[model samples]
Structures are given as C-alpha cells and as structure tokens.
Target: MIQKNKYLIGVIALLALALFTVPCLAMEGPDSIELDSLAELYEPVQFDHIMHVEAAGDDCSVCHHHTTGTPVQDENCIGCHANSGEADEVACSACHPANRFQADYLNKIDENYRLNHVDKVGLKAAYHIKCMGCHEENDAPTGCQDCHTRTEAGDKMFRSGKYAPKGGNKSRKSGH
Candidate 1:
C-alpha cells in the first residue's frame, strides 16, 4: 500500500507539472499576423508575430493584448467587437460604421485620432499602440518604413533571415 501511494503521488506531481508547462511552451502565436486593422493608414502592416514572440522571450500576452486569464478562444475577435453572439466572422469594416473611403482615413486627419485616439482605442489605435509601443519600449525601430517594407526586394530580404532585435542576438530572459 505504501509503495502504491508513493507511485501515485509521483505520477500526480508529474501530471501537474506537465499541465502547466505545456501551455507556456506551446502557446503558438501565428508566424505572421497581418495587422490590416489599420491598412487605411499604411499598406497593412504584416506584423512579425514570431519575431515579437522570440524578442519578448515568449511573453505572448503583450501582442495578444489580453489578460493571462481572459476568457478567450471562445470565438474570434469580431464576436465581442460587434457585440453579438450570432455576428458573422467578417472584415472589421462590415460592422464598424467608420468611413474608410474618406481621403482623411489614411492620414487620420480627424482630430479624434490626433488628440483622443487613445481614449476609445479603435482598431487602428489598438494595433499602432501595441506594436509601436512595444518597439519603442524595446528600442526597436518606430519608423513606418522599417516595418511596412512589403516590396518585391523587401519581401526577399524579409524571408531570407530571422528577425532579431538590435542587440538581441540571444533570446530575451526566459521565465517559466
């Protein structure tokens, strides 16, 4: 009986450890998430999700922009954003009442974007703030050209090498 109990206890401990560690190690962010949320501003920033994950050393929540325990994977983003359970999974513009065709759309010449953008934090603001903020925080490039280089030559260069931070040859500090 004693030996059997010891084996059971050991198995339980291993199972518990595996349950916790697997999610941390296996939280696979998509390789390249297109941040077309703000395409009107720039030519839809194709964010290097994998690069960001490696740079932040596996802190997936930063770009995910969610709390560690937030109820997620229940549905895609549009479900909550459009405020409907039956809402169709579609382009953001499908439900959002914003005028994308306006000339000022790209420029964000509207004063709300210029002054109070952070308050409501629209799709454009969310992407920009998260991406640009992380870049600025990490001393990464904030220049639009640095990220949005999707030209013929640029695509070749981008795919050729894995992106590391300016001084981050090694991965960021690991936590588990």
Candidate 2:
C-alpha cells in the first residue's frame, strides 16, 4: 500500500510539472521571423519577434488576436471572442488568406454563410494593420521604407530610383 501511494504521488507531481512547463516552452517563439509572403514587391521583412513580444509585455493576443488563449483585448473582438480559446494553429496565414481577393477564396467566404469573419482582411493587410497601428501608438517608425525596401520591380512600378524619368522637370511644349 505504501509503495502504491508513493508511485501515485510521483505520477501526479510529474503531471503537474508538465502542465506548467509545456505551455511556457510553447510560448517561447522564434526570436525573429522573415516575413516574405509579400516579397514580390518589397524585400522580406526581418521581424524581431522577441523584441515585439517583450514590447507587448508577453501578451501574444496583441498581434495574434484571440488565438493564443489570451482574452481578447480589442473592444470590437471581445464581444464575439472573449472566451474563444487557443487555436490549433497560431500562424497569421493560417487564418488570413494570402490571396484574399482570389475568386476561389472569395467564393468560399460567400458560400460559408455561418463564417463569423466574413470581412477578414488579407495577409498583407493584416500585417500592415497590426504592425502600423502598434507602431503608431508606440511612436515607432511607421514609414514604408522603415519596414519595407522596394525591390527592383517595385521601383520600376513606382517609377522611382533609377527608373525615375530622366531630365529635371524640364517642361516640354506639346505640338498641336
């Protein structure tokens, strides 16, 4: 009887330790992440995830919405997701579609009448909205160049850098 009791206590202690330690280990995300989903135009953003985590005071919900099991902080979201627990996947792209406006994706959204997030933003817009909003509030760099450097394709599209039209604004007379 004494041996059985000791073994039971040992199992219970191990279970308790695992319950506390596993979540903490899972919460420690990568120190940095290369955000390259929109790399077609801009260079991949080297996001300092650890810094942002610290800045957010370890609250994953600041950027992760209600996916991290944290109570929703946004007044707009709290109504629907106050108790919506942790999601199976926490990646942004898992929920926000990369090609949000694609016909198939739009059709799916339209077909799913029960989907609560009918107006969900695309992946690119999600990053910009969340990052820019927080940066603005924290007085961090909010300029495009601060986070994204345009690629050659982007420069050409904007007609900037070397792609800019030559000649220093010399007015040309139109021949009638």
Candidate 3:
C-alpha cells in the first residue's frame, strides 16, 4: 500500500509541524528572557531556553523561527524574531549603532517609551531595541535590570530557567 501511504504522509507532516511550531514556541514577550546571563557582546549568550532549544537543534523552525500566521519554514524564529528593519535584521541599530552613547542612551530610551496611554515601550525599549542593540554593538549589558523588569524583576526573570523540548518555555503564549 505504498508503504502505508508513505506512513500516512509522514504522520501528516509531523502533525502539521506540531500545529505550526507549537504556538510559535508558545508565544513570548512577557519581558521574555528564559535566561540571558548578560554576556554576549556580539554573538553568543542568549541561551537558557533549556540551553537554546535543547543545544541549538530541537527545531523551532531552526532559527528561521517565525510567528504571525505560521507556515513553519523549517522552524523560523526569524533569526531572532525579525522585523527590526528586515533583511538580516535584528533591529535596534542592529547592534546599538546611533554612535553608542550607551547605545545612544538606549536609543533615547527607545524613543521615549510610554506605558498606560500605551505608546509604551518596556521590554527595556523592546530589549534595547533588540537585545541591547546586539549586546551594545558587541559590548553587552546596557544596564537597567540588564533588560527591563518591574514586578520583582519579572518574578526573578521567571524563576531563572528550565525550558526544554518539553514545552520550551513560551513565557505566556501569544501567537496564532
């Protein structure tokens, strides 16, 4: 039977890539930080998702990680959640580059972030406009909770750690 119809179409494409990358890693951003030990100056140290999705390979779209109406393009995490100016982009001056006055005062505190009126910008100015502008253009820790936190430092950065393939810590879940 054609090998059981190719094993039922490879178990229906691995159950439609786990219903599209398990809710895009169960959506995040409740001040997202599964364990950023503060030390990646330019390219190394965002680990702590149970050690980067299980030693960098459990596949959450394999770094191509994405969200917004999924398609599961090999597990796109959009190379670190795209849209900072697109193209190989990681935004926030793509590594803090408005000429570094402390990443230009945290990009002017992310263009004067607000809160209640909602023009708000707290994730430490969207994570210093994207992970301390690439760890301060490769220097790291722009201080201030090292990335913003309020309620008891977001409950001590969500109890510090322990996300593995068994749920991969989505922080709060918010994708479709």
Candidate 4:
C-alpha cells in the first residue's frame, strides 16, 4: 500500500511540473525575427521580437490574436473566436496570404464559406496595420523610413537620389 502511495505521489508531482512549464515553453520564441517577406524595394527589417514582447507586457494576444491560447481581446474577433483556443501556427504569414490578390487565392477565399476571413488583409497590410496602429498609439515613429530603409531599387523607383528628375522640374513649352 505504501509503495502504491509513493508511486502516485511521484506521478502527481510530474504532472504538476508539466502543467506549469508547458505554458512557459509555448511562450518561448526567437529573440529577433528578420522580416523579409516584403523586402523587394526595401531592406529586410531586423525586428527585435524580445523588445516588442516586453513592450506588449508579454501578452501574446496583442499581436498573435488568440493563437497563443490567450483570450481574444479584439472585439471584432471575440464573436467567433472567444474560445477558439491555440492555433497550430501563429505566424502572420501562416494565415494571411502574401499573394492575396492572385486569382487562385481569391477563388479560395470565395469558396470557403465557413471561414469568415473575407475581410482579412494581406500579409503586408497586416504587418503595417498592426505595427502602425501600435506605433501611433505609443507615439512611436510611423514614417516609412522609420522602420524600413529604401533599397537602391526603391530609390530608382521613387525617382530619388541619382534617379531624381533631371533639370529640376523644368516646364515644357507646348508648340501650338
């Protein structure tokens, strides 16, 4: 009887340890994440994930929605996902498609009647919306250059630097 009691206690102890440590393990993430998904015209953003995590007070729901097993805080999402639980993947790109305007992606969204994600923004828009909203609220920088440095390709596209309009916007005389 005593041997059985000892074995039960050991199992209970192990279960308790697992329960407490599981959440911590789930919250663990890389210190930094290189954001290069939309780095065509701009350099990749070296995102300091740890810093944002601290700024968010370690609340994963702030950015991850209800994917981190945290309660849904956004009123728009609370209706359908109040108790939806943790997701298999939490990365923004996992749900928000990069080629959201593509014909196939549009068709997929159109066919999925059960998913009420029709209004969901694309990956780039998602990043901008989430980041810019927070930055605005916290009085952080919202300028394009504040987060992303334009690449040489971007400069050329924008007609800036060496690509600036030659002759300083000279007016062309129309021959009548």
Best by TM-score: 4
- Candidate 3 lDDT over 47-125, as tens digits, reads 3444434433444433323433333453233454454222344222244333333566566657767622223343334
The TM-score-based order of candidates, best leading, equals: 4, 2, 1, 3
Q: What digit string (tens of lDDT, one per residue) describes model 4 on residues 112-173? A: 85776887899999999999999999999999999999999999999998889988978898
TM-score of 4: 0.79
- Please list the residue runs of candidate 2 whose C-alpha ends up more than 4 Å from where it truly belongs after superposition: 1-26, 170-176
- Alpha-carbon deviation at 119 in model 4, angstroms: 1.3
lDDT values for all models: 0.53, 0.86, 0.44, 0.86
Q: What is the C-alpha RMSD of each candidate to the true structure, in Å?
A: 14.2, 8.2, 17.2, 8.3
TM-score of each: 0.42, 0.78, 0.22, 0.79
Q: Candidates sorted by lDDT, descending order?
A: 4, 2, 1, 3
lDDT of 3: 0.44
Over 4 Å off in model 1, which ranges? 1-21, 67-120, 149-176
Q: Distance (Å) between predicted and true CA of 158, model 2?
A: 0.8
